[model samples]
Target: MELRRITYENVDAVTSMSVRDEQQNFVAPNVASLAEAYVCVDNGYAVKAFALYEGDEPVGFVMLGLGYMGWSAPPCAEGSYCIVRFMIDQRYQGRGLGKKGMEACLEYLREKPLGSADKVWLSYEPENTAARELYHKLGFIENGEMCGEETAAVRDL
Candidate 1:
């Protein structure tokens, strides 16, 4: 799988991607994420939104925040990167693409695409055991922090 920047040609496909019905409450929709990306850019913050692809098919979405320190409940230190939003479409959920996509995100962040950072942070609803498991397998340990109601976790770059 590969991460591709959202462009005019793929914007519709990206925005239309959806997670499973049961997971609707765990993540914001792609359109909302894109809107946040736009607002972040407008407000002078670094954000990268991408469409995850398997061959030519769009399978997931991820948005990254770089050096953002404006969280009302700061779960990460300044200069850290955050996986602000992530979701694999319902159609792609059981295909192991989530791990591949996350690996891609971490690879991208390790390059410091927006700026230098030594860690990557993410949060998930406490009840989302699937997410917590996946994140833990990917090396994210809960730091006993919260970003709003979500449990915060971090991993070294």
Candidate 2:
């Protein structure tokens, strides 16, 4: 599995990806995330949005915020990176790609691709047990913080 930048050539495929109906509320759509990426860039913040691929097939998407401090919820401490958005296409569910994709994201973040950071953060809907479990298994711990209505978690980089 590999994470590729969402270029014009793959933007269509990435934006068309969707999660299962039941999970629709858990993540923002790729297009919206792309829009946010644009806004972040315009506002001088760093962000990375990528399409998760397996042998050239787009199966998921991830967006990362680097050293960003614009959250309405208590912002992450300085020098923190956040997983702003993530999703596996409905067709790719149950294939173990979600874990691989997340690992890929973490790997990319560990490189400090956009900037320096000591931790990676993410949030999920309070009821999204699958996400909570996966994140915990991957070493993220909830710090009793909230990002909007979601529960926030963080892991050392």
Residue runs of model 1 more than 4 Å from their true location after superposition: 75-77
Q: What is the lDDT of residue 34 in candidate 2?
A: 93
User: What tens-digit string does per-residue lDDT give for candidate 2 at 13-66?
Assistant: 998998878898999899999998888888888887889998889999998887
lDDT string, candidate 1, 27-100, tens digits: 99999999989988888889889999989999999999876635464647567899999999999897899999
Q: Which model scores highest in TM-score?
A: 1
Tell me each candidate's RMSD, in Å, in order: 1.1, 1.2
Among the numbered candidates, top lDDT falls to: 1
What does the lDDT read for residue 125 in candidate 2? Answer: 97
Considering summed lDDT, which 10 consecutive residues are worst modelled in model 2? 68-77
Candidate 2, residue 82: Cα displacement in angstroms equals 0.5
Question: What is the model-wide C-alpha lDDT for candidate 2?
Answer: 0.86
Error of 2 at 66 (Å): 1.5
Relative to the true structure, candidate 2 reaches a TM of: 0.95
